[model samples]
Target: MNKYRITVADKNPLVLSGLETLFKNDDRFILTGTARTGAEFIELAAQNKFDIGVTGWEMPGLDGRAILDAIGEFEYHPKIVIYTGVPNPRIIREAMLNGAAGFYAKGDSTEQLITTVASVAAGQMVFPYFDLKKLQDDPWESLTRRELDLLDYLKTGQSNQQIANYLGLSVNTIKFHLKNLYTKLGVKNRAQAVAVSLSRKSNH
Candidate 1:
């Protein structure tokens, strides 16, 4: 049987060591590399070819999202599996949107992790179960803190310039943030963003 090449990245040394040992013991998988930082992971990924890239979502310098984005620049794109302790609906949604193959919670069994990686390697998308309706209905969880704050400013009918002045950010910077905010909120413009926020607030 042809073994699948895999790379693992996490901030935790113990997690890296454990996964290295686990994959080494599994005849089906070839542990190509291990990284304790996202930068290191990206470097290793660039230097080697991997069938699957297993990594935590949160890491110092660069992140799972960054890694996913970086793959587009590579000649060979590896299937990414986010193995994060902080698994949230927003993270799952982002992973799905970014073409990640899997999102496995760290608390799950090693067997489940192995199964998830295997399934992904076999052209499958695996993610922890989450409420799709709730995720859609309350996209507030998807917003970054800056985005939430911008939403509040929008609610007050603050113009981008005014909001930027208040936040001590350049108008262009605010626009960049608003662009990301609108995407996350599934809105076209400020009016729609404010409307969605108000609608969600009224329900609570």
Candidate 2:
């Protein structure tokens, strides 16, 4: 039988090594690549295709959310399943909204991990099932890195020019970001956007 190809991305070296060992020992799996950062994972994903991508919520250059957004541009979208220690409903909801077909919280058993990978690779959307209806319909999960950064600056009461200078982006570019940011945040202008951003931050 041909082994299922897998790639994993997590910041911790220990986690990387352990997962590598896990997959290595499994006759049914072939670990193709393991990365320490979301940026590296994206590069690796572009270079080689895999059966599934197992990622975490937090990463260096792009967080798992942004990684999902970036990969939307790829011609072939790999089946992504988040394997995260964070069991936050907010994060899990975001991952589900963003594009992860399934997730395995750190507390889940090793058997569950293997089963999840197999299920997702076979094109199943494996949610915990009970929590789907409870997940909020917040559009906040759709915000990209740049868009979130723009809103972060706005939270500090930065004007367009100030934000442009702070981010080292041109004002025209800032305006472009603002347009998309407004849409994603579901706000008409800067004030509403800032209020929404700050409110969400307090929740976290």
Among the numbered candidates, top TM-score falls to 1
Top lDDT hit: 1
Candidate 1, superposed: residue stretches over 4 Å from native: 144-174, 179-204
**Where does candidate 1 have its weakest 10-residue lDDT segment?**
138-147
lDDT of 1 by residue, 15-75 (tens): 9899999889999999999999989999998999899989998877777777788876898
The clash number for model 1 is 0
User: At residue 91, what lDDT does model 1 achieve?
Assistant: 83
lDDT of 2 by residue, 65-183 (tens): 88888877899988888888976666776778788889888788877888888889778987664354444355665565578777878878888999899767799999998999898
In model 1, the Cα lDDT at residue 42 comes to: 90
> What local distance difference test score does each model get?
0.88, 0.82
Inter-residue clash pairs, candidate 2? none
